[model samples]
Target: MANIIKKIKRKHKKKKLQAERAKMEQSRQNRTPEDAYQERLSKHRSAVIRRAVMTVVAVAAVATLFFFYMEKRSYHNYKILSASEQEDVVATNYAEMSGKILRYSPDGASLVSDTMDTYWSTLYEMQNPVADVRDDRAVIADQDGTLLEMFDKDGETGSVTTSYNIIKARVSSSGMVAAILDGGDATWINFYGSDGTLIAENQTHLADPGYPLDVAVSDSGDIMMVAYQFVDGSETTSYVAFYNFGDVGQSEDDRIVSGYTYDGVVIPQIMYLDGNRSAAIRDDGFTLYKGSQIPKEVETIKVDKEIVSTFYDDNIIGLVFKNGDKDKPYTMRGYSTDGSLKFEKKFNIPYTTIKASGGNILLYNSSQISVMNSRGVEKYSGTVDGTISDFIKTGWNRYLLVLDNGVDVIKLS
Candidate 1:
């Protein structure tokens, strides 16, 4: 009986121990995998939130910068308008020392300005100011007898042989040919490629070699010279001639004024202001020639003092003179297209002729400049500390005022 009892107890104990082992294994498997999966899910969610936050921050920063930048630029342009007293929109520094005011051309380029500034230095000292913007090229005649042609887009596009006797050098309207009159009274016009290749050269004789004061090129690239001659030992005569590059005998109109001058007077300066209009200032008064040779009536403007210069506008001509014997005061008198009296103004300072911009007249009298309306009313006046020499109209609204010391951008406001 005792042996049977021991066997039953041992079997019962083995079954209980097996049941405990199975339960522990099931719990172990469930706990390990569930905890690991939960931890992995938490880590993935944290990484996704981090990426989304960073993206939003970066986008916000870019938007802020862009908005401020645009606002700043808008304020800048508006500031230019608020500073004008007359409420006229004028741009100061329309041209730079090297940059010149040019008529708007969609095809070709030309240097259109009041006078020449030492082109060598002007071409290099361009700033980002609005005044220095131009489309014309610079034709530089250096002291070393180097003729360089620089385009607004291309630097140093062409050059020509420096005139050995270089009395006056001028570029054609197309900016392709350079006509030079040598000191030996020899004149040669050479056409060059934009790459500095010699294309053609035409040598011609001037009407009067003794006094060659002005040279001009028509819009068609025709070269002409205005020379002076002495009829008798006492009086002077003026003559004008033309050369059509190489198309010499194509027409009977090779040279007009091939005759002689009625009055023995020399022309001080000459200019072809536009296609059909021409003007010359002589010792006596200003004269206009219509269509190259047809002489118009001489417009003699009365100057209060010695007449220093006469300039031609599109429809009017102006004569500037010293006001009195003192040579300090000056007056600018305007004339109609038909030599009729337009209007005149007397200034306290000696006046220098400046180009008209935006239908307004700009005059520099010594160290002071006066801006006038088309009717000769003084709109705004400013005092320039330096001696003013030259000025150019950038357009109808702006000008580049140049002095011996520096340049000022004067806008019509």
Candidate 2:
């Protein structure tokens, strides 16, 4: 009896499943053409979406692989995009300005584009010409001479005839010119507009506040920094003076906003890192100052090892020291304006110019060039066939190799 009942239950379950299947088939047969088309369209749409997703994933994977390959591959050659006429590197001093090259000589100066078009050019004469650039403005002065010429991105702005010989000269971003002039028993700091008009002049004697070692104007063309060195008693001391030409400094004596004095330490080099920051490069170490209205000392980094070379931009301050390590004898360090160390890289290249730009350290000599990223990873170390006066990074894997022969715009491959 139990076996018969189990067989009956199984037959009922099978009949129910068969009836549901027949009902579903009848529903499909009675359906409208629109319904059937909708069903097919839905399935087709899902299939198309899946294929699109798969293709996107494959393309992304390929792009990632290509990026890694390019990053890791060692570049040994370059492809020149354009070439300029051959200009002797000695006759022309080239400086990068707004993605173009400022080619200047004792005879003249011109700002030329990468496509071999001259933006502007002017003729001048000097026995010894020295150029100092700040932003788009540049001041080219004749050392031990009185001729001072100024330029901008457009063309020649002004020319000044100094009464005293110019020991050193600097230009601000807004086209303010400052010159250290030689006096008979003193030094004169003369400030001038880009229009060749004298704005102000201050004289310093060695027996007084001291001899101005170096002078730098702020990018805003409002502040001036002078590093003065003097001997008092048996110890030699230095003073880092900051003067403001803005309205905030009008009431103060000589427009003095802030100043610092150092005893027994010589600060021969001073510069305005930006509008709000300044640096006084001392013989032993370096000091950074900050402020717009009143300049004050923010940080000082002391160095035990002798600094071999130093370079900086608005964002980074770099120092290269002679390391004690025999294998890697050069230690390159980068710091922010707050005195925080960013990177410490070890290299052995006998570099001529060390430049920090866009978070990469670029070092190059006459033939060899090396590039290291912010993480101290050497991305490129290669050589060019010609004598390189300037190796400028134009873009990713691209450089402007300013050789003695011509300008070779190249891409790393």
Candidate 3:
């Protein structure tokens, strides 16, 4: 009985130990499979993540390259040729404090700045101030007298001293300077070159005391002087006398071709009338001179109101006429070369400042500068900082803007 009892106890202990070993083996099997699966899953996930990151980086690099390529293409497309290819640009700077003048080429646009004092041509402390600028020069007057100074990209040539105290100075695009000289026994008029060399001198032996108030020099090198009174003194005739510089101080055969007079009391706005040859404006009436000497062939355009601003190109002459008083609105009219009125439009927004280039027009009210084409289509306008005192066109679509603190040249895309 004791042996049987001991055997049974040993069998029960063996069974218990077998059960414990089986449970430990089962737990180890389960843990080892799970650990292997987890490690494999972690490696797979890392590979997937690395692939995704690389794909994203590659896409971003391609996009960046495409963006730079587009930018470079656009830049090349809108590039403008230098003025030496066609036309030249003349820039002017006024030093308000020192009362001096600075001039430079439009190509070297970076040169005009507060440091202009270091690069100006004539560095004299002016007493009065520069009254007007035209052609490639400025008319500076002081208590001593008035002098016409021509400036290039480098500096100024010697000034052309006029005997007549010029009430108004007008310069042609061809660089001809005309002023209202003193009317007396010794009073006369003359045109000077950019180097202050006398080109042509004209003295009028008028039966009456007649003085030329305004003058126009054409691109073909024809000088037209609009005198208020004629020698006969009957009708208040505006004399259009033409002079030639090719024959300086010569006889009648060497004189310039004199054309017929378009008579009126129209004060010659010399700068606007002279620069463009195909167009002419006399107050409310605008005419297109088609290079024909016949007076009847000239196209005459009549407007209902007085003219405010006039823009002339090779094809058309755009006139801004005041519709009503200053409190009322204004209208702009476009006229053709055949004296035909083409289009008339009204602007509710009065342009406080206006500038024209070729057929492109720019109007600045206060906050924005509106750009418009010759067809009266609004192109694109942009906002400016502070007050824009003045701005001028540089290249085909670039502008040199004068700000309060500094000057910036903006190129639009």
Candidate 4:
């Protein structure tokens, strides 16, 4: 009976050992090699994804902080000048040569000196008067482009009567005038000397170079640039042609010195920087031309952003575009005649008009005015107390603010 009991105890112990071994094998089988590898890979992938997400968040936070700092800097640099009130100003312009201010209305035009004294006022039969002021002369033409009268600080200089209605007119610094006339079946680009003598005329037809969209004359009245636009089916083409009446263009065909044709461009504004330099502003961008006899293509600037507005004077071309930011509404960019970017700046104000003078730019509306240098640096920002009708630059750092009641000279240094 003792031997049997001992054998039973040994059997029980063996069964217990077997059960333990089976459980260990089952646990090893459940954790397979493929399952272990997959588990390790999932942990590693999760860690990598978490690191990537943290890096992105850090970068975004830095970018947002940088933009906020830049906006604060811009606001801190802005300034406000003194305010004044003015009234009954229809149009205003500044003559840099004589240091005088020109105020015009439908009734007449007046030239005022720096002392606010009216030098002269000339009355004409003007239904809608449009004035263009340069350094030495000012030209007031009817909105219809027909009756054009030139004036100086002294008095009326010359007048030109057009046979066809005038669509647009521009005067050079020396009083040379170029007018685009609306002919019946065609259009005419007429160039006149300072004394209102017809210098040259080019009749543009729809079939040849198309209609003249814009015209510009040289300071000496020796060259004329015309922007001609034509449509062929769904495609639109623009041609900027240089016409020279001087001896340098004698060898060219019909005085057509040089021209550039662009597809899918519509250039509505062209101006001569000087006798040899000219620029044409289009929807896409602007082209700078330089030559003696004819304008040679110097550089072509292509703008990526949508252009909101454009302003040009004798020397600088200014373009205002949306900045794609809510804090800064617009960006003003100035380019030189050689197609070099001179300055770029962002502003919050929505300017109604922009003008580039010698070394400065003037931006104004009915209530606000901003002055900036050629380098896109804001020099001053101020408000006109009363409702502003028109304003003109009296000096490099001065503006004749025309209010609804009177005119105030604002000096911003």
Q: How many collisions between residues are there in candidate 1? A: 8
Q: Write the per-residue lDDT of candidate 3 for residues 142-193, one digit (tens) a residue.
A: 3234555655434555467666654555555455565556646644666666
After superposing candidate 4 on the true structure, give the runs of residues whose Cα lies further than 4 Å from its correct spot.
1-87, 90-98
Instruction: Order the numbered candidates by TM-score, best leading.
Output: 2, 4, 3, 1
lDDT for 85 (candidate 4): 38
Candidate 1: global Cα-lDDT?
A: 0.51
Residues 150-251, model 4: lDDT tens digits: 876687888888888888888877788888888889888888776778887778898789889888777776787889999977889999998888898888
Q: Rank the candidates by lDDT, best first.
A: 2, 4, 3, 1
lDDT of 4 at 83: 38
Provide the lowest-lDDT 10-residue window in model 4: 71-80
Per-model TM against the reference: 0.56, 0.80, 0.58, 0.75
Every candidate's lDDT: 0.51, 0.85, 0.53, 0.77
Task: Kindly list the per-residue Cα lDDT of model 2 for residues 48-126, writing each as its tens digit.
Answer: 9999999999999999999777556665566788887667666777776766677788898899876658888899888
As a TM-score, model 1 comes out at: 0.56
lDDT of 1 by residue, 171-266 (tens): 444454443445454555454544556655545454434445565554444434354444555666676544444344245454333333536656
What residue pairs clash in candidate 3, if any at all? 164-182
Q: In terms of lDDT, which candidate is stronger, 1 or 2?
A: 2
